[model samples]
Target: MKIAFIGHDLKFLNDAIEFFEHSPNISVKIDKWEGHEIKDEQASLEIVEWADILFCEWGLGNVVWYQKHKKPHQKLIVRMHRFEMNTIYPSQFDYHKIDKIIAISPYVYEEFHRVASIPREKMTVVYNGVQTEKFEKVKSSKAKYNIGIIGIVPKLKRLDRAIEIFEELYRRNNKYQLYIKGKHPKEFGWVWNNQAEREFYEEVFRKIENSPFKKNVHFEGWGDVTSWLKKVGYVLSVSDYESFHMAPIEGMASGAFPVVLKREGVNVVFPKDYIFETIEDAINFISENDFSTNNNLKTFVKENYSLTNMCNQIMDIFLEK
Candidate 1:
């Protein structure tokens, strides 16, 4: 099978390529656009012509490009990760050319179905894969007070809300601290280029600056967080929305208990016990829950969200009628 995977963010797709390439009958190629918009029409056309199957990581503009240029015999599959469901991209997608729609979570699939009016048989849900073995480590006892939030893309993630919860946690116990691992707003430009995003980011920054526990709040730019997770007792997901967020699961794989907010379809993606409807509930759960000992968190993710399992499922989607 000749496969072409197109997307701006190809990081997650790398594992799929690596695993699939070893299969004797399969050949994989990636066209990394590296931008929000797909500008090279010629390149997209060439890819569509070359591949038997085209898999787009996000149902963004790239899928639209494939929809325009795709051959009659070719199978086009686009994975809806998140964010795109809220945008105009779904409406722009040419479903006539798309054979199947892959949503990372059931919630995203339902939302996409409602918005696009795609038939039930045309879609399937695939959870985001995590390399659980890579993140396995012995957590330090001192990590008990460290609360971690992995990704901070834009205002929608609600970092300000996280800080508010952190503030309340610190009031009860000064030992608590927030450790953020992704791109800080001060360092990232493109996501916050718009005035509304800029204002939202600035508001979060202002809250961080004014907070009494400012010194305890640490920001480490995006990188390999496998080692760092050992020092994090709790991983926070306070996002307003997410399709199938890998951060919380990754944290769980690394032995950090997740305290996820009640986002749309989050309950479907994560264990219901880990979810909270409000900041107060999250705080109470964290205060009462003991994460010092080892549990089945890693085992659960390894069994369900492993890269090997994800690849097999994806390959089935590609090969199936």
Candidate 2:
């Protein structure tokens, strides 16, 4: 079958695409629409028309294009990641034309259901696939004191909370340092489209600046996180929300314990022991645990969240009669 993937989030789609492309009798193509809007109308329509199925990575204006131009026999599937749910775009999708809607997590499916009035059967929860091989690096001895956080631009990521937890750890022992893997919001103005988000970003910046442990804060710009994960003892996912946060799972694969906040759908992905409700609780947990020992976290992720597993589930849905 011929499949066309449309969206700006091609980076996240890499593993899934790799799995699909290697299968027999399957062809895949991707169109890069960076903004909320798709500027190349003719190219977008041509790709939509070429595919037997249209898989939109984000439920934004590109989905609207599919809603208008998708062929009668072609199946339209829109995957709504975390950020799109906050916008009005989900409501704007023409469900009559869409064959399936994939929510990356249960929480996102629930949120999409509330907005779209779509049938529960029409939507499926497929967790993000992580390249476990990339994260199988050995952890350095120095990693015991370094804490890591990935993806810093989104205010929803709650880097401020991660900083607070790191500060608490530093208070007990000055060895703790935060190594952030993504760009700050101040560096990417387009991420915070509204004034409210801009204000929230500014507040987080101020908090980071005013903190006494600011000197220990390291802003490492984005790239392949596997190398960076090797230098960290623990991975922190202090997000206010997530559809399916992959960093912690990746960290676990890299031999680092992942301390993630207990978000609405965290239980669906992470073990309860790794999910903490409060920063103080997280601090206490970190203080008590031995960083040198492995908890089989990598095995759990390998079994459930691997690229092959995720692709099999997605392929089943795509091939369903």
Candidate 3:
């Protein structure tokens, strides 16, 4: 079977692509749009024609393009993430042309159905899986005091809220520190250009610099998150919203306890004990120093959201008549 993965950002598609690539009966190819615009129309058209299945990673412009150009016999599968629902792209999809719609979580599935009027029978929820083996349990002595936030882009990630939790934790225990992974807003020209986004980040920076624990807060930038996870005893997901936040799951697989802010539908994805209702609740949870459940956390992710499970589920979709 020939499969083509199409998207502007293919980072989340890596494990699924690798799974198919290793199969002797299947061939895989990816065609990434240079940003949102298709730089090479002929190349995209060729891939669309060649593939037996077209997996559109995000329910973005690619879905709109594929819906218009795909052959009648070709199967088109679109995977919708949280951010896309907030945009105009979902309204533009021709549901009749789409064979299947994959939502990363139940919340996303319902949102797409309600917002875009996509038929319920055409949609299915597939939780994002983590490679548990890659993020093996390794912890430093002071790791129990270290908190990690994976991404902080577009301000919705709530880095400011993370600082608030971290501040209170550091007040009680000075050993508590924060390690942020991923790029700064300054790295993205689009984010830096928006006046509101610019001010949001500027204020976030100001808060960090002015805080009493200023020296403890560290922006490590982007690197191997698995390696960084070893130093993080607790992983935080304080996002305003998420389709399915993977960082906390990955942290769990790495044997780090997760302290998540309860966003809408987050309870459907994570355990209640790991989720907090407010900044004070998060601070209190981390202050408890209960690290004995690290093994249980790793087992939870391994059994529930492993890469092998995700690959098999997606492969089943590919082979389904």
Candidate 4:
């Protein structure tokens, strides 16, 4: 099948590319209008119309804009990432002339229901897949501490909460240093809604500047997860709502503690007591918990969220037909 993904998002294009690498008969090409940038807008529209199936994500909004003008007939499978569908509001949702939907988490699908009516069969929940072969555990340095957070950082991510948690940890013992691998919002000081998000991110660099913990907060803008995992000593993801994803999964793949927030609906997959309620609690737990003795989470992720399991489940949907 000639599957074309329309997005600049690394996951939408890269993940599918990874699958195609392993897939026997599937042929896939991902472009959120690469030709448009070089040639003309009409040139990009040609690719979308030609594709057997279209996978739209991240910058799909850009294509939807063209849909208003060009009227391309691409059977879209819109994939929702974590940041795109956090709230269930009319303004928040971006509508495309789509045939089916692919959500990285269930939470996004439910949010989609709030915006438009779609049958359960039409919307598929395909959890994020980790390239386990590349992101396995690394030897942690005992003397030098390296705590990290690996994901897109929006306000919902609660990276500040992670910082506070670390502050407490440092007060008790200053062994661990922190690395937060997310871009800070460019209007943190002003009303974020009023300021453009990218502009706000520009301001955030100035705000966090010259702070005491500035040395600890390392912002390595998005890159190779497998390579990043090797440098990460620990991983923290404290989001308020998740369909079921983000840093924790990648961290777990890399043998990080995979600290997540304690929310009510989390019991479906995550075991009891897996959620941490407070920063104080996380501080205390990490201070004493010996990771060498705790590879249980490591094993759980290996068995469940591995690449083979994720791809098999996705292929199951097409095969069922």
Candidate 5:
């Protein structure tokens, strides 16, 4: 089958690309275009004409565009991943404009129902997954009070919240560390054109560095996950909201006990083996546990959220019709 994938916020990596490419009888012709570069109407119509199946992410504009010009025989599938369900994707579009909808988690689909007419059978939960071999468990040397926060564009991640909790932890014992990876896109040479945002990040980074408990903090820029997971024993994902925060799951794969907040719809979707209510409670829980139980934790995540499982879940949805 000839398939075309449309994504703007995230570009699928090599593994994700290869996973889709190797699917049974699939001939993927990925169209790499962002929302900003979508000025060419002919380009979109051409893609719509070429694809037998369409996969889109968080782009309702594309959804409308596809509805306007998609071939009657082509299969349409839109994937929703952002936290804002009602605000981003409204119900009006679902009445006649779309076909299959893929959500990263069950909670995400529940949220999607707020504005879409998708029934349980029409929606599928395809969890965002990572390669277990790349983000495999590591031999953590010691259980320091280190916290790891990993993401690319973190508008809602609320790293400051994690910083505040760590500040409290450091007050009792000054051995804690917060290792921040990922290069700041708004800070480097790219900032030369957009100085205002650059200055804002400069202030943000400065405050993070001077955050009362700065001595224990370390700014380890972007690199491999295996190398950094060793320095952190626990992960704090205090984001404003999440459709599917795969970072915490990846952290779990690396043996770092994730102390994630119990999202409303997430409890039903993700296993309750290690979720905690508050940062304090999570801290206490992590203090008592060691990396020796990493295998069990990793196994739980691997079974539910690994790349193979994620792809299989999605394939089940595509084949359901």
Candidate 6:
């Protein structure tokens, strides 16, 4: 089978792509877009023409383009993430032409069905999987008091909320610290260019600078998060919303307890014990640390969201008529 995967960002598709490439009777090719725009139309067109199946990694312009251009015999699958729902791209899809719509979480599936009126049978939920083996359980001496938040960009991630939680944790125990991983707002050209986004981040920076626990908060910037997870005892997901937040799962795989703020579909994605209803609830949970339960957390991730399980489910979809 000839498969072509197209997307603006292909990072999440790595494991699945590798799995397919090694499988018998399958050939894979990937075409990437330059951010939101098509990097090379001719190159993408050639891949589309050659493949028996086309997989759109994000429900972005690539999917819309593929829907209009693909031959009738070609099967097209598009994966939709949470951010795309807020954009105009989801409405542009011709549901009849799309062979399958893959939602990363149950919440996303319901939203697409309600907002876009897509048939329930047309969509399938495929929770985001983490490479459990890569994030081996290891920790520093001070890891028990450390909190980690991955991806703070695009204000909706709620970096402000994370800081608030960290501050309270610091008040109870001066040993507590926050280690943030990912790019700053200035690193993202689109965010930095927007006046509203620029001001929002400026305020976040100002709050951090003025806070007493400012020295305790560390922005580690972009790096291999798996290695950094060793220093993090708790992985925080205080986002306003999420389809399936992977940071906490990755943290769990690395023996870090996840303290997630309740989001629309978080309950479907994580155990109730890992979720927090309010700031005080999250602080109390972290304060009463039982590090011995870390093994159970790792087991949960391996059993439910392993890389092998995700690949098998996706492979079944690919081979389906």
**Local distance difference test, per candidate?**
0.84, 0.83, 0.88, 0.60, 0.68, 0.87
What would the C-alpha RMSD of candidate 6 be, to one decimal place? 1.4
Residue 209 of model 6, lDDT score: 98
Worst 10 residues of 1 by lDDT: 285-294
- Between the candidate structures 4 and 6, which one is better when assessed by lDDT? 6
Candidate 2 vs candidate 5, TM-score winner: 2
lDDT string for model 4 (144-176, tens) is 256787653455565557777766766666667
Worst 10 residues of 3 by lDDT: 288-297
Off by over 4 Å in 1: 187-191
1-321, model 3: which lDDT tens digit per residue?
999999999888787788789988899889888865577889899997799999999988888888899998899999888788777888888888998999988999998888888789999988898878898855888899899999999799988898988888888989888999999899999999999999999998998888889999999889888899988999999988888989999999989988888888898899898888888888888898677657789889988898888888888887888
TM-score of candidate 2 versus the correct structure, residues matched by position: 0.93
Q: Point out where model 6 deviates above 4 Å.
A: none
| Candidate 5 lDDT over residue span 82-136, tens digit each | 5335454444355355677778777778766655546766667777777777766
Q: Give the Cα-based TM-score of candidate 3 against the true structure.
A: 0.97
Residue 312, model 4, lDDT: 77
| Model 2 C-alpha lDDT per residue in residues 1-321, reported as the tens digit of each score | 998889977778987887788889999888888688988777887896689989898888888878898888888888888788667787777778988888888888887778666578789998888878888887888898899998976677877788789888989988888898987676776766778778877787687798888898998897878888889888998987777888888888888888988878899888888899888889998878887677587888888888887888888878887
Candidate 5 Cα lDDT to native? 0.68
Q: TM-score winner between 1 and 5, please give it.
A: 1
Off by over 4 Å in 5: 12-14, 83-97, 115-121, 143-145, 152-155, 183-207, 221-223
Which pairs clash (backbone N, Cα, C closer than 3 Å) in model 3? none
Across 56-102, the per-residue lDDT of candidate 6 in tens digits comes to 99898898888889999999998888778777888888988999999
TM-score for each candidate, following the candidate numbering: 0.93, 0.93, 0.97, 0.77, 0.83, 0.96
